[model samples]
Target: MVDRRLFDIARWSLMVAVWLLPVLYVFGLMRLLHLENAYHTCTQARFGVPDDRGLPVFGRLDSDVLPPRSVCTWVDGYTLDRVPWFVTPTMFVCLVVAAAASPVVISARRRGVMAGTARRPW
Candidate 1:
């Protein structure tokens, strides 16, 4: 039989971790949103060109006069957006913590059930 105190601690830990999952998710989602917004801002601030539709067009226009006497232009707007501090690490930590803690929770639940069954009056 496992120590009751240890069981309690493990059970509580799992509960706390489970509760923390949503908080972690919120933080991660916020971080991602902020990164996306920053990307949008920076993109518009840098290679943003005002198109005929009044939309910010990203990328550079390359004009080549030696290519069969034709002008060519291409839009290049693929880059890694900068995320705020602790976003990536926190995300990873949250994911790992949740994943690791889940098994612990399951074990605790199984133990609790077993303990309950063992104590049955019948």
Candidate 2:
């Protein structure tokens, strides 16, 4: 049982590492984009804006203290890539699904419950 638990944990850990690392990284990148203002500007430029920047011209909600046309700029390329719309939230949803599935899979496997008819292995 303990071995099974360890195996389950290890398997899930590898699954998470393989499936989630890039997505999580991308999610983090998206957050950075919003925080650093690079994502906003890129989105703005895509919509045809005059500023040589990435996001829309309107400053973020918190930055309302700045001037109306206050253009936010980031100093690093790490902040330059705009997270595609809805990608971060989607990644979060996937993470949630993965987390929820891990325990269910572990429990089911530990019980040796197979959902479908098995074809005998030679």
**What pairs collide in candidate 2?**
40-55, 41-54, 41-55, 42-54, 42-55
lDDT of 2 by residue, 9-122 (tens): 555664774587476655555444333344445445445553555433443322221111223334342222233445556565656766766766666566554333333467
Off by over 4 Å in 2: 1-21, 27-81, 114-122
| Model 2: lowest-lDDT 10 consecutive positions | 61-70
Clashing pairs in 1: none
Give Cα-based local distance difference scores for all models.
0.46, 0.47
Worst 10 residues of 1 by lDDT: 63-72
The C-alpha local distance difference test score for the whole of candidate 1 amounts to: 0.46
